[model samples]
Target: MEWYLKVLKNYFGFSGRARRKEYWMFVLISTVISIVLSLVDLGIGTFDEETGSGLLSTIYGLAVLIPTIAVSFRRLHDTNHSAWWLLIVLIPFLGALFLLIVFCFDSKEDNQYGPNPKAIPDDNAEIEA
Candidate 1:
């Protein structure tokens, strides 16, 4: 839950690395929310021919889009890749495949972009008084 909120707080931020837990947790929670909302929309027959509102479904998708892109870009940053790579997903099937590969790959340790986000800070390091 902390991770989910952290990601949301950084919703529009795309300049830093995100650890696997942060990225995956955000994805998991968002997916669960989407599923639950979808179920409710279906149950209410929001799109029923007689009388249904499409507004709720549209809002749901819009709500998730920002975090989705932010996480994906941060995931790429974790791999030391430029966030611009996200544009690749605009292509056909290949784009999504590429993103999947990137998201699944382990973060590079000490890459030019930055240090591995998965590494824990040294407890013995001196702190300024």
Candidate 2:
């Protein structure tokens, strides 16, 4: 939940590196929220069978669209890849597979993108005794 909130707080931030936990946590939580919204829309008859999305779900997707891209870009930066690498998603199955593999790669040492996210201390972390 902290990771998800951190990403949302960054909102349009795309210039820094994103740790894998940050990126994946946002994905996981957002996916769960979308599912819940879809169920709500279904119960309210707002879900459209044609597009397979509901009013709330659609709105939520649009709301997070930019943030999602921003996080992906930052994740790429963490892996030492340019944001342009995201274009590979247009290549069908292979592109997504390639990106999935890349996203799983360990974060590189401080690169042109910025310092390694893992090296930065979290402001919200509890102080050690």
Please report the candidate that would top lDDT against the real structure.
Answer: 2
Model 1 is weakest, by summed lDDT over 10 consecutive residues, at 120-129
Clashes of each: 0, 0
What global local distance difference test value does model 2 have? 0.93
lDDT of 1 by residue, 71-93 (tens): 88888898778999999999999
TM-score of each: 0.78, 0.94
Most TM-score-accurate candidate: 2
Q: Each candidate's lDDT (Cα)?
A: 0.76, 0.93
Where model 1 places Cα greater than 4 Å from the true spot, the runs are 48-54, 120-129
